[model samples]
Target: MLWTIIGIIFVLWLLGFLFDIAGNLVHVLLVIALIVFIFQMMAGRRKG
Candidate 1:
């Protein structure tokens, strides 16, 4: 579930990056997604 959400966020981020939309907001969102993905991975690793 987390992976799926992360994947969606990644695709959206890629689309935003490619299209250059939303200006700084897109960049901030991309960074936030990255951080969330990293935190999810870390949590998953600890659980495993």
Candidate 2:
């Protein structure tokens, strides 16, 4: 589920780059997704 969200965001980010559409929003979302991914990894490490 997390991976799917990240993949969608990545695709949107790429499209934004190529078409110059909603680039800022897509970049922000990408950053947010990355932060979430990192956080999840850190939390998982703490549990294990």
Best by TM-score: 2
Q: What TM-score, computed on C-alpha atoms, does each candidate reach? A: 0.65, 0.94
The lDDT of each candidate is 0.78, 0.97
lDDT of 2 by residue, 1-48 (tens): 999999999999999999999859999999999999999999999999
What's the CA error at residue 9 for candidate 2, in Å?
A: 0.2
Candidate 2: where are CA atoms >4 Å away?
none
Taking all chains together, the TM-score of candidate 2 against the true structure is 0.94
RMSD after CA superposition, every candidate:
1.9, 0.6
Looking at model 2, report the run of 10 residues with the lowest lDDT sum. Answer: 14-23
Per-residue alpha-carbon lDDT of candidate 1 for residues 14-45, written as tens digits (9 for 90 to 100): 78889976667766766787798899889989
C-alpha-based local distance difference test score of model 1 = 0.78
- The CA-based lDDT of model 2 is what? 0.97
